[model samples]
Target chain A: MDLATSGGEPERFGPTIGTLGEDALVSGVIDRYPSAPWLTVGPGDDAAVLDLTGSLAGPLIACTDTIVEGQDFLRHWSTARDIGIKVAAQNFADVAAMGGRPHTLLVSLTTPADVPAGWANSLADGLAAECSRAGAVVAGGDVSSGAEIAVTGTALGTLAVPRAVLRSGARPGDLIAVTPGSGRSAAGWALLRAGLRDVEDPVLAALVREHRAPVPPYPAGVEAALAGASAMIDTSDGLVRDALRVARASGAVLDLDPDALRPSADLLRAASVLGSAAGSEPEPDPRDWVLTGGEDHALLACFPPSAVVPAAFGVIGRVRSGEPGVWLGGRPFTGEGGWRHWS
Target chain B: MDLATSGGEPERFGPTIGTLGEDALVSGVIDRYPSAPWLTVGPGDDAAVLDLTGSLAGPLIACTDTIVEGQDFLRHWSTARDIGIKVAAQNFADVAAMGGRPHTLLVSLTTPADVPAGWANSLADGLAAECSRAGAVVAGGDVSSGAEIAVTGTALGTLAVPRAVLRSGARPGDLIAVTPGSGRSAAGWALLRAGLRDVEDPVLAALVREHRAPVPPYPAGVEAALAGASAMIDTSDGLVRDALRVARASGAVLDLDPDALRPSADLLRAASVLGSAAGSEPEPDPRDWVLTGGEDHALLACFPPSAVVPAAFGVIGRVRSGEPGVWLGGRPFTGEGGWRHWS
Candidate 1:
């Protein structure tokens, strides 16, 4: 995982949250996050107050996402800090996809009484580190007891442009492109599920870390919006599934090019190792990972052919007026879709 | 409980959420909320977009609160709808305490697979009902799977005046007051705990209902702020405990008059019933419920001597310059405190 190093290692040896009352736990952890200038009244009060008067003119974007232990992450595969970072990243990506600048986040963590008090502090560090990276601050939050650990983040952001880049804005003759960094998390998930956390290959070990925490290209989203991009979405789901969402929303077809994908050779090597580990199985294709893997949080947007795409984004396909669906290599790409809760 | 009868009873006999899947479950429930004019982009998007541009010119207020099953409420005492309303009310009260008008709420719900598909719809109905009452809308939210049901809501609001009423703004000569509705929920909690759900006493039964769902005096908060109130807080905890918060935050003493409190006669009846049920020789004092019982969610504010306090608020005490603490009838009121998460 991409952990923060500047704060020094957290003093993990401490009392459990059950012993330290809620007020003490909150006071100890709230200071971990740096306050934004916009915050007038912060933690220790009933609510937080932010001055966003002249900075934002139009719609303020808001979204909430929750990560539950055992379902979203396993204790064996991730630490409390890792869980905090992952939750913040996933929630922030939604605001970024809307072509907005993230401002503040409200995080609520519910855990069992048996959890260590220091776990909350480390989680706050991870949350603060990610929020700092995304140009936001942890404004306020709530904590309560639950059967397991569940972290919920509500992200609020301001628009950089007049209107948000929505899924339905894509039109025919638009170029379908994605910001760099996709499909690595799915590969890491596969390796971890296969009991290969300590992979011998250095590249594969990095993939395992990437799976624990995937970084999204946050700045490219606003740049694309500023450059007159049409439709946009974060690839939290697999490429084809999210592409299909744009296609269906816009009533257009997303025709992807296989040659433009440039699937990673390292992923291909990992695929071979995974296939052999399962035994007597057909070798999986790295292209499948590039096309169908989820949680990479890469920005996928459609721009007019004449619009100047950001240098960091790679052209992957073109939008067409046809049956609303995703097309791969001039064929109807029907494959297993991305992650869904309780499926 | 203050149940909404406008919408017909929620259709509870339906498929379980596990069988229906998250996408279907969300789509089926999202429509239950009423759309606000400020909502430019609501649910079914990357994030909700709210147009709070010209209307709110000053600092915006935000707060989050979560409710978990078994800890906050019992399924036998509360329906899915009651849980939704109670959670929304509690979160909204925080914004109200800040002298702000609640505008939007982003809610996240984590539930187990065995939860009924219709349970979410009923929960949404309750959320919408409470949001309507508070003049706020359910902007957006997320649903995920976990071991138990937990609802977390982040409430965002706009200040009614140029400045927010903070806990530390109280002056020594301020008048301490509360909006109607205090000690009822505590009485209700006592009745429910004593296995008096089917109590023949109508007054006690109402308390039971009030415990399951509380209706806070939300509008009184903004009125207090607009009327130049010094400081404010919501009585989510017991009266004495929340009073202590204002006293400590302001570094002033709050001397309360027991006669002005007008402790509820219904609660006195509840205490006797509870005492007999427990086979206690001495009946529990109802005054203790008024002093230490929590979850009433009344607005407690301190106004300057010359400020025109809102008519709905009942003067209960006066602030004095002395040791920072709360006093009852001219004596230090050292009693059991309010709710704590891990305690």
Candidate 2:
């Protein structure tokens, strides 16, 4: 349990977090990020004071999420750095979904005493890198001991426009569009579960990487908003589930065209290899993954029929006057395939 | 494992969290609080939008903290309601320390799948009650399944004045004062650890209750700010430890007078009972708890010597030019009795 050493060989061994105590552990995590001008009072205080006097034109948008061990992730499946990147991406996507730009993040981490100090350092690096990519800063955070590793992140953002693109704004004639690269994360998770480690196939390897670290379309949300999107949401739960959410919130029916959702080249290639690897089981459907896979973090928006859709977005469905539900190929699609924390 | 039952008998049994699913569990938790006008978009969306236009005169102050089971509290020692109240009080105190008025809270809970549904409901009720007590509202939160119960709270507040009271603002010849009641929480924790539970002594019982639920003077923070307090911090990490923080940050020496910290009546009574219950061991010093016991969340502030100390605050120490550290009775106090997360 005493995994302490002087050298920087984190892969082999490092000092356990308990040996260094709370103050040193905190300094190690915070030293990775540079100070920004917006932070009036940074991490080493009771609370962080932010100066947003003229930075925002409208109200502030806030969101919080927690990822727990054994429930949301497994250590053997992803590195500590990957966990950090994934959490930042998850929270930033919420701000993007509201057509706002993320400004600061407040992170709370709970870990076992025996965890290696290198794990926390790598996590801080990952968080700093991802926040830089999203144009935000890690303003403050708290660390404590716990039974397992659990991270809860809160993202704060500013709305530069007059109004935010809410989910309840879709109209009957709006065209439903989604960002490209849907179902890659789900396909990646499926490949990992199918015992495809260190995959020789390029497509399968890419899928696995997508599963480990998803690069959400952060800028596409603001672009869609400027392009006059009536409603907007991120595909964190699945294309079907998220679309249904907008439909129910707007009191309209979303009809998907089957031909529009043809599997991408990478998905098809991965599916072929997975089918060949499986001797007896049926081949997994790539189309089904595209329809129901979660954690893609793609932007899904409703644009007017007369409006020109952004080049980054593709039209996949249309809103119509009907009961609040999702329909595919003029038929109601009944499927229960989405992320559920308790189940 | 299936502890489900109808009627209002949460104490007896109830359905596990897994059986109800995520949406239902979230609904069960959120239905406890009433809606407020400041919450433009509440819990059901991707993020909670708050309209702060014309609500404050200065920038925002934000803070977050997490409480984990087995690390911060034990189930047998404190009820779920106590846990909820303690978390809220702790977060609110941080905002108050900055001389800010807390406006809203965002809570995230991670619990085991086998946890009873009633526990979540009661926790929500406790959080609502305490938030109401502090003149704040629960705008949003996230709930997920984990190995143990962990709560992370984010509190957002606004500085009504032009500037905030910072820890680095204390100068030489300033007066160090603290809100009334400091050692009761620590004394209560000691009594609990000493197996003095269910005591016939009313003073000891009140001490135990204080340990479970600390009522910080929230309004006094703003009063101190309006009265031109130069430096301020909350006593979350013992009086001596927090005093050292201000000293180090301000580059000055803080000297405490032993006579000024006279033991409260409840502390004296609790110490007497603990000593009698010690059997053959030496009696623990109540002064140690007063100096090194944390979690009291008492506001510690520095004001100019010429300024009138608020009637609610008690003067205990003074600032002077010397090496940066805490001094007691004109001598440097050397004690290693503060809470450490990973030790």
Residue lDDT tens for model 1, A237-284? 888889998999899999999898867877877788888995435666
Q: Per-residue lDDT for B1-343 in model 2, tens only?
A: 1122111327335788889888788888888876677787878778888887566536788999999988787766676777788888999999999999888889999988888888888778778878888888888899888888999999989876678898898899999999977888889888878876556678887888778778889998888888889899999888998999899999999998889988887788777777787362566678888898888989999999888888879999999999999999889999777778977
Candidate 2: stretches off by over 4 Å: A1-12, A195-197, A200-203, A278-282, B1-12, B194-202, B278-282
User: What DockQ results for candidate 2?
Assistant: 0.77
Clashing pairs in 2: A3-A14, B3-B14
Best by DockQ: 1
Please provide TM-scores computed only on chain A for all of the candidate models, following their numbering. Answer: 0.93, 0.93
**TM-score for chain B of all predictions:** 0.93, 0.94
Cα displacement (angstroms), candidate 1, residue B294, comes to 1.5
The residue-by-residue lDDT of candidate 1 on B270-336, one tens digit each, is: 8877888855446667787788888999999999999998997999999999999999888998788
Give every collision pair in model 1.
B17-B117
| TM-scores vs. true structure, each candidate | 0.94, 0.93
Going through the candidates in order, what fraction of the true interface contacts does each contain? 0.92, 0.85
Among the numbered candidates, top lDDT falls to 1
Which docking category, incorrect, acceptable, medium or high, applies to candidate 1?
Answer: high
